[model samples]
Target: MKNYWYRFKHYPFYQHKWFRISLASLLLSVFFFLITISNVYTETYSIERFTEAKETIRSPLSIENEKETERERRAAIQSVEDRYEISTEITQERVGYVNELFEAIDKIDEEENDSGQSGDDGNTVSDKEKAQDLQQMISPEISDALQREDLIQLITASPNHRSLGKELLTTSLYDVMNDGVTTENMQTGIDNIKEKLQYSSLDASLKEVLYLISEFAVVENSFYDAEKTVEAQKHASSNVEPVMIRAGEIIVTEGQTITNEIYEELKLVGLLSDDRNVYPLVGLILLILLIGAMISYEMNNYAAKRELDAGKIASIILISVLMVAVMKVTSLFTGSVNQLFFIVPAATGAMLLKILLDERLALVLSMMYAILASLIFNSEIPGSLNMEAGIFILFSQLAGIAFLVNLKDRMAILKAGIGITLVHILTVLLFLFLSFEKYSMADVFTYMGFGAVAAFLSTVLTIGLLPFFETGLGILSDTKLLTLSNPNHPLLRKILIEAPGTYHHSVMVANLSESACEAIGANGLLARVAAYYHDLGKTEKAHYFIENQMGITNPHDMLQPEQSAGIIINHPYAGGKLLKKHKLPKEIIHITEQHHGTSLLKYFYFKAKEQNKYVKEADYRYPGPLPKTQEGAIVCICDSVEAAVRSLKEPTKEKIAEIVSSIINDKLMDGQLNDSPLTFKELEKIRQAVCEALNGIFHSRIQYPTNQEVKEAN
Candidate 1:
């Protein structure tokens, strides 16, 4: 039963990540299709003319009837009377002409008096002569209107009367023409002049003459302002907003005949028949394909070559699908409150991926989740995408990613969550400010609250789900490494109790390997954990290893070189078995087994060769699969370098650097590090890091004088 269970757990078919990814994609697509299918299933109507509705229908969206609105605006603009300006200059000029005529008449009378013409006699200038003379002085048209008697009265009138007449005529013309006066209001202006003159002491005939002069002075001053009128009409039209049919508002009731207006509204809301429109489905498929391609490309490029196995792929797919599911489920409650979409825990996936995988892959997956969110949470516009939600998710995920970079502890997830919340708040405010809609404080706060909740929930869910994915998927997250690095771990505790010297040595090696691996961009935590367990098998025979022998005589001295080499060779394999028994991760087991590599045990090999001329080099060599990964290779170099440097009588920085370089060069010559992915540049960096660490560990210390020596010197 145990064997069957183990086999079932490791079954390839059940663990095939490609198939899991495909299934996850299909499920996501189905969910998206279910949510958005309503946009495609529009109802068809056949009514062409207006008809009475069987039931009342509301607009599906707010839209403007541009033609009707424009018509109303134009009518309003046209209702405003044409504006005009009064020309005071014309009034002044006409008054001056009348004065000149009077002056000319006075001049003619003076000349007739000087010539000794008697008044009221035939010899005096006749009224006909005066009239003929006035004709030449004024315009011929005005001269024709004046009668001989009128001319005679004007010539005989006093200067005060002429001045009074001129004042009344000019004042009435100025009053009437100063306002907007068109040809349509000319007679009205004339009547107003007559009324004003009637109250005067002037004769009725004189008032009538003043009225005629006022009428002639009146000219059209107001003109049509077509540009200003058109501009006003446009302003009014623009102020008329497009009527919107909000989401969930009814368009046409069932069994109701659709009118042209109703049909257009339905079409605007994407409710009209669109049986031939496969564009949405096609677009959805294309988007899915694009996401899949990105995932494939990113995984191929970012993950370690051997680490690009089914398990990691499964983990990636699981994280993505879980995030998408959270978004979809949250969308179900979105209703009219689209901001509820912010409560979907968008940062959780990026945080999980960053913890379980590489940060680059996490960033890529964050983008994918953001894009999917935009598509899924667009409930307000059925067929349209919600770009604001997409941007919000993008920044939220990025915040988590940024916070998780170089993270050292599991509790940092909470800090990252807080960061994500802040980012979400900022993102929500930015989008709100960008929108044309007016949002109340309550609405803004509500949306911001949702964003905060989303960020907090991401932290909560990531913390809650972390252990499960790490344990279930056998993923060696940094948190898991930290846990294993703890001194309280059973294996670590066992090593400490059974072989204290070995435990101390392992700790020193761990420090060296961690720094070295980190310098080369490798998994430093994994290297540290592996270093702690690398010598666990030494507990079974603590006295055989020199470090744990403490002051005891060397047991290897009594044993043959072959026997000592065999014992040394078996320790790595034995440690690997013990790790398996403890159910530790395979990566740790592999690192422990490969740290010794296949390098020849020079001490044993040379000693045996001196004793027996036929001693074989292979007999003194360790059985190894070499260092297959950079972390494992780093452990191998640190393990040897730590032991070598600890044996120095009085170590200096130079001595430590020499020994570290020697050990690394020997490993390279022996082909032990050939299988590792470390480049030449990375190896140089690792060498420098190892030297720096060893220098710190074995730096020269000041020696204080003994009490007796100090007293003697004094």
Candidate 2:
């Protein structure tokens, strides 16, 4: 029975029955809530007191003539026919042109074939027969020149081959030098043609003929059928004309009656979809799925990675579910309230999510929340669903949450809340402008005011609910940490008085860590608070550390090195105990326990080594499991960097930068930074922030003389 119970309890699927039930319940609730809200908003929007519908909302094209339908039908058919006729004409013209060029090609091919067959025994031919053959022969260049329809058309009326003649001469001159196209071949072809037709007959009038022959030779050597086809296609396509079809009104004269066939065609084309409805259902579904996935993934990752208590998980999930329910309720009031009233539902959910969860998940879930809110208020499928409105709200609310990332104080969150409000309003305003739809300025202003109110309420809800989750859920938000760990807070003040030196050192480390976190967009306030409470164990043995000792002789100098190492190494656990005794948050206790990690007190270990020569390195290290929370991890870095910088007799910015970088690198190499959210780019930013803070802390101050010294100088 014990073995079965253990296996069942440890199984992941069975361990969190409450979570599974809650998630399923939440999904069902959202579906029903949306349905209920949709009905309510529809009813309220229809009420005259909420929104006064104009008595007549005439179609924009009502002024057009009634016979417009018949006239448009005839015009469209005629336009298509004309286009077809024009396209056919261009195609026929191309085919005819290509046929003429092919005829010239056949004439040249027939002459070449006849000459090849007439050759006798490979040797004997009469000069007269040769001359007749040469005279009858079409120059290969001329044949090719005629085949190029573009060039042929250019000289079809009166052939001019001056350009071709010049180009051929230039090409042949280079070829002759390279011994490629020999002068002898050129001379033989020329002489044969000249003997048949006298040299004097080859006048400038015949210059076109000479160049044409040369062009044929060049083209026949290089021309492919594909090239001619492409040329023909270009010719055919260039002559085709665009056909235009008029849009808008299809009515004719006012007295004319509409035909059933025309009306049915228009209806089919959606110029008149008076019946079927197409809701923006896909967008709404996508929004829901995306939001649900983000929330689920974030919640799971947080629970698993942080090893949060079951109670904390329940609290976080409870708050998330409650926020969704609140949003549904608020959406119901959208009609009585301004259009901007819907933003309250969106911003409130976003702020709560951001506070309870991390920014990436919050932003993603907020978009889903926005989509759900849209579906609630605008459920009508065909003409009523405001898809643009939903999208605008989603994007603006997402931007708002993104802008609030890593904020250090409540005021900052409040300020960001206002900014988020403005973004939501502006999004709506832009939508209105682009829509070009008629809406009233009074309504717009009313919605803007509603948006402001919504933003304020969102901030209020977030602030009020934060502490419940922080304490009951054992969750620590940036705002909660910043508020509780303030310098003037009662508990912090007590720590300062009880251990003044440790308190001062903590404050300095907080400054270092907070700025570092901010530079890198990590949780700055969390880091700062963690840094403050990291040394709470020192309160128990304040006199032992050098900072609390002042100029007094070191207590460790008298004590054995092993005893001293134990005292120093044990402070982290002691601090954790002290924090727990005071009922401080678990995260704070973790900060105390993990700040030192398992790092060794090397000085004490070496001191023991020299004295007894029998000490193990393990005896000098702190009893640690290292930092688990982002805050704890950040505190560890800040603590080491601050102490190392301060210990330097005269630390400059350059030296501090190097030392800070080296310490962080060592921690990274030791795998201390693995679980933290900080990426490499963020670490570099933290390094810069640390360097800046260190420079300020270690700034050189002028020494003032004592009375005795002043008297001696005088």
Off by over 4 Å in 2: 1-291, 294-320, 330-344, 379-384, 388-392, 395-406, 412-453, 551-553, 610-614, 629-631, 652-688, 701-714
lDDT of 2 at 475: 75
Location of the lowest summed lDDT over 10 successive residues in candidate 1:
38-47
> TM-score for each prediction?
0.69, 0.55
The lDDT values for all models are 0.77, 0.60
* Collision pairs in model 1: 60-245, 61-244, 61-245, 62-243, 62-244, 62-245, 63-243, 84-222
Model 1: runs farther than 4 Å from truth? 1-139, 147-166, 170-202, 207-262, 265-271, 274-301, 304-308, 324-347, 359-411, 414-456, 493-505, 536-574, 600-624, 642-659, 688-714
Q: Report the Cα lDDT for residue 313, model 2.
A: 55
lDDT per residue for candidate 2 within 422-459, as digits (tens), equals 87678667766776567789867766766677677767
What RMSD does each model have against the real structure? 7.7, 21.7
